[model samples]
Target: MNPSLRNALTRLAFMLVAAAAALPAAANIDIQHWVAPNGARVYFVESRVLPILDVQVDFDAGAARDPAGKSGVASMTQSLLDTGAGGLDEDTLAERFTDLGAQLGGVADNDRAGLSLRTLSSARERDGSLALLRTLLTQPEFPAAVLDREKARAISGLREADTKPDAIGSKRFARALYGDHPYGRTPTIESVTAISRDDLVAHYRTHYVASRAVVSIVGDVTREQAEAIAVQLTGDLPQGEPLAPIPAVTLPQASTENIAHPANQSHIFVGQPALQRGDLDFFPLQVGNYILGGGGFVSRLTKEVREKRGYAYSVYSYFNPQRQLGAFQIGLQTERSQAAAALKVVDETLAAFMAKGPTEDELRAAKRNLVDGFSLRLDSNRKLLDSLAVIGFYGLPLDWLKKFPERAEAVTAAQVKDAFQRRLSADNIVRVIVAGD
Candidate 1:
């Protein structure tokens, strides 16, 4: 090889290495926020890596706000929103979505109803997908035929779910925890069957209002284009009064109930309703829960219930805070013969943790794992978009993500013990064990 040629190659390689070293670290996520002229909240983040667009429209219409005797109305209403809209029938709407190569979806949980769309970023695809979203949000047809079919499906699902021991335990657990609250009532087959097209239409018109919706958009689009899309999608939505406020969730009085079931394994749901979105105790509780159960194989529950005694394959606990007070549930399934022993161990562990709290080593490991694992939560545009939506919907601070690590690291052992003692009382916890000896 000539000396000149060899020297040139070495220079090129050195330059490439220098350039790579100069590149910035990848922890930054650029989020943009604005309010639409029509009063809808909009959040956007542009990413050109993927030639796709993801949009979600969320409303305050959740099951907790359902009226008496209409336990499933919120979910049913959300389902029918996109089934038939504007002048399109269900079949036509589905065909159009498929033809455009777009996916339309809906999700209904205890605290919100959401409709989402994912489409290619091409102009034709974006416009077509947005048009369908507009119809679903504004001009849902709620045709009589589609309503009947959906009702039948819901009822059939309920009937099938009733036969399973896990299902029975969950249904009874919710009822026992929530009592007469809307959150406690699972939709009955009869109640679902009674829901009609008019009922859904009325529910949509009342709750799916523009002022109540939060629009989240992420992907291959500019801020200007995202604003136009948001308006075009939600402009025609009814401008109605804000939804009626959800009443505070009252934590039920403490009690233990063991229901008889024929299943060979017992299902247990134990805990109480605790915490909400902006609660001050959230960070401490979250960190403590990691030590208690949410941290997979490293969690105390797993160590006690599975590794030590082999009583169950898995055991977990989590604090699900929502618009109102949410449940802090610990659950496991074990052979009926071993259920009592398993429950005893679980209670002992929980009681000991509450009284003494996690040790220094446990707290350090929990913080390390949570902080180190935070990057994976925001690695994709879709995940970032979802986080932005939750922040917007729950009115969390714009810097919530940035502050998460600091909060986790700041949690003291005394604070965890104090928070747990204040938030959870073993004597006041609700214990439901199904098919236990």
Candidate 2:
């Protein structure tokens, strides 16, 4: 086949798949899971509807896993995977993916870090992409020149972020909420400067091992093919022991900080550490949060602060469930003069919602919205791949997508209220304001 013609076909197929993905899909997500011989957990979803395949391999190597005093190591390590792998430099690596019409990506967060790939499922493209991924997994070079260049770039970026009000408020809010926990630590110039090429190699060798890997594959592939891909990707990795679990989050005492900034608007963040992944309360919390603030204009927070009082352009709240206890944050920006008044309304709204919970009608509407829109979540192979990665990495049930709506519908008003009351308190939430009066 002519190379140009093959590339065009790949593009057309990807476009067709994307168009099909825009429609609602069946809620029944059948995930076939197994553990590879090398101890890598694998999750597979076979979808022959599209010619594209998506794969994500996650490991317990996110920010929380960064060595003490090396806050940026995990992110840097993941970023540099394709910079130099299997004797190929970064530019050559990029050319290979381009020529194959495949996409290579990376993921980094507080709890997990790894890579993802999208490619045509034909044997040539599929096999080629997987080979490159395998090389990244088992043979990243961590070249010294690339490390120093990236370090300088990261430090420059961090310095620029320090001057922004929203960034300052966010870092301050995290510090206030998580205190000395690793979750609170964001990369600073000092920390990034402290990291060395040796740190990246050590972090990868310690955390990016076969035993800790969760490989999630979705798209046009058979079970046998998927099994082979999983093994081929992880088989060469060292079967090192999983690292110790990240420390559990503890609630910090409530405190209010008003940082002086020259910005015209005040950036405000308020909340506390709340739920973790797989918590039963997620259903109630998810349902209730929509009524409280997650819903757009209809939410209580938006109605109170943005609609009635017009104190801010927008206000929203959410519960971020993570591998460890995550944040329940309400965030907004308003005129500096009205910041305190807006915050007062926010506090009152949160307190009332905790005390009374969502009304019966609110509960019904929330459930209706959530359940009705659930199909869209699984409509795409990429989305399915994300769901698979989460399920495999977190050890969630295979039927999680299938049963999501049922569980959401089962949440009652009383349950939402109870969950909120138990999980949040007015006294313990941290409040941080930048440029407030």
Go through the candidates in order and give the clash count of each: 0, 0
Give the C-alpha lDDT of model 1. Answer: 0.84
What root-mean-square deviation over C-alphas does model 2 reach?
1.7
lDDT of 1 by residue, 349-415 (tens): 9999999999999999999998888867776555677787888788887777778888888999899
- Top lDDT prediction, candidate number: 2
Q: Extract clashing residue pairs from model 2.
A: none
Q: Model 2, which residues run further than 4 Å from truth?
A: 1-26
* Per-candidate TM-score against the hidden true structure: 0.92, 0.97
Give model 2's clash tally: 0
Cα error, residue 397 of model 1, in Å, equals 0.7
The prediction achieving the highest TM-score against the true structure is: 2
As a TM-score, model 1 comes out at: 0.92
